[model samples]
Target: MKTKAVRMYGTDDLRLEEFELPQIKEDEILVKIMSDSICMSTYKLVKQGKKHKRAPQNMDTNPVIVGHECSGLIVEVGNKWKDHFRPGQKFSLQPALNYMGKLDSPGYSYEFCGGACTYCIMPNEVMELGCLLDYTGESFFEASLGEPMSCIIGGFHANYHTNKRNYDHAMGTKTDGNILIMGGCGPMGLGAVSYGLQFENKPKRIVVTDISDERIARAKEVISEETALERGIQLLYVNTAKMKDPISELMAITGGHGYDDVFVYVPVKEVAEMGDKLLAFDGCMNFFAGPSDSQFQAEINLYNCHYTSTHIMGTTGGNTDDLVEANQLSAKGAIEAAVMVTHIGGIDSIAEATKNLPSIPGGKKLTYTQFDMPLTAIGDFEELGKTDPLFQKLSESCKAHKGLWNGEAEKILFHHFGINPKEL
Candidate 1:
């Protein structure tokens, strides 16, 4: 079978090309990728190329496709997995396949198995390690976003607080406790806000801080204060850039008690240090951002670490369990994965969209593998509609849903492109 995918040659080198795919073995599977959401991790991978730990070293010779947060339908299921998986089944996968203690993963290391493609092959290890997942969500974008949602979920689970009496550690954030998310306007940070609000052990209050008023305002509009209050949780959005004393103002929200759970979403030194200072006694801080620099360092107060029992930890990607939980929540409409997506493009736009992801303002850049369009933001759909009928339909659908992308918009896009989801 012939498949079109974006392949990496070296640092900052990616090309979209069509090639013939090798036949799937009895233990393998073939998938038709429908939707793939561009990740900042993919941008980092492009910057480092083979230098990245998860990327293959021989990329100059054997290029690998570059996308991981993806979802689609099973085109063919090999005999070995015929009983468990069948053709025409919608699916996604846990890309962080820590198999055999190796850093290798799909999108970074695989030649025939990645997300930014029309069709791809799934190697044996994917199913063997239980990373291949079946998705029954209404939108393929939701399934594609499940991977990132899992990472957020993992960060929450990785946080731990110790008990003074038994010296025991309690997993996850404290129930009915104050929570703070630094640099919380980004897609992942906003996702943390949504998840934190709907979490089983819901926090009493969540304070989201960011430097940009535009982003903070958008976050509030998407997940409104009324919405948070309906769930019995208090949500506050703060723009620290305007404050004369940001720390004092932030701490005042918690009555100077400080936050029980603090998550640093930006890799900036100041953000990390600020999160360290905001930690309450026995507070657990999670560094959720992946820094591009290998020697990235941040200062933490040892006094608080030793005396107050405050500590910090970092996590990369989520495990299979976290992925499963994310999928379940998204499938049930408990969380809005669409909030992460701000732009939509086709497979042709992935190379530029990924290479310049940081410069591209807004949230997730969602790509449809089979379409052919430039990277266009959901906000610009109405403007683009003046020149393009396709954008006009998209603008109508998005406007109907409060300027956010939804499944109806997705179906409209697919139909406009003459691609039938049922056929795929």
Candidate 2:
């Protein structure tokens, strides 16, 4: 099948192109893309092409249909694929194709299936190890966040190791401990916020520290305001660049005792070192993001490390199991995965959407322009018996407004959103 997709040909350059792909094999299925939550990694691919070792390398150029974080409807199924996938189930795309690399996977590494495209062939590995799932009425956009959700779920599932302790401690399941995430306003960091404060068992406090006040304010919009107050999700805004000692600033926020668990999302050298200094006894340090060339070193005083019983650990992409847990959480409404995505655009608007990705005012960035309904309108999914007209209008209006986004906020009524005010 030939589908319209965002084709990446080089660094900082992308375009809407038509690509030819084989039809589903007996073991495959065809998916109609519903929603794509903009992945930071996908943005990274655009900024730094080819260098991403796992990115598809085109000898002709550096073009690849670059998107992994997505959810879609199963349109067609192969003879062998029917047992697992129905004709129209909402499912997240498990795009990271290489797991142990036993054989070729359609959407993990080089030939990864893209969520950015309108349609794709769901490979065999995707069906067998399908982390992607959707309830009856849920929008693809809501389910699309599953990829990011899976990664966080994976990191949380990892048994964090520390030389200070005799045994490996699980980072994600802690309840009584103090959870502090540095640079917690970003997408990966915010996911930690949702997982810690909303989904995880009763956390003592989900404290997020970031340099930007704007980002902190935006973060508050996604997570519950009342629940955060009730559950003690204190948002800490600090200017690390101005602080003589960021550790001291963080220390003050934790009432000078330091953190019980620190999830470090920012990869800046000094920020990491600062995180190491503020670890309390038997505390776990989770380095969530990776450094550019592996030269990024986090320093800690040896005596303090040994005496303080501090453990430092890092994790990358999660295994398939985490994806499964994420789906359940989404289905149950614990994480509110779908609502976190604030904007929805389409393939032609890829460039515009990416420009806003780095500075998204709220939680998740999404691409749902190609779809038929608003994510919210798809609720009560069990009866996938009928379509909603309101959703159709919203989706179509989103596409129309997307075409008119010229950086200047012009007044245009989105017929679908029913927001017909003269003001945009």
Please write out the lDDT profile of model 1 over residues 174-219, one tens digit for every residue.
9999999999989999899989988887899999999998998889
Please report the TM-score between candidate 1 and the true structure.
0.99
The whole-model C-alpha lDDT of candidate 1 against the native structure comes to 0.92
Among these predictions, the greatest lDDT belongs to: 1
Candidate 1 global Cα RMSD: 0.9
Collision count for each candidate, in order: 0, 12
All candidates: TM-score = 0.99, 0.78
Looking at model 2, residue 17 earns an lDDT score of 72
Instruction: Kindly list the per-residue Cα lDDT of model 2 for residues 314-348, writing each as its tens digit.
Output: 88776666776777776666775543455445466
Best candidate (score: TM-score) = 1
Error of 2 at 159 (Å): 6.0
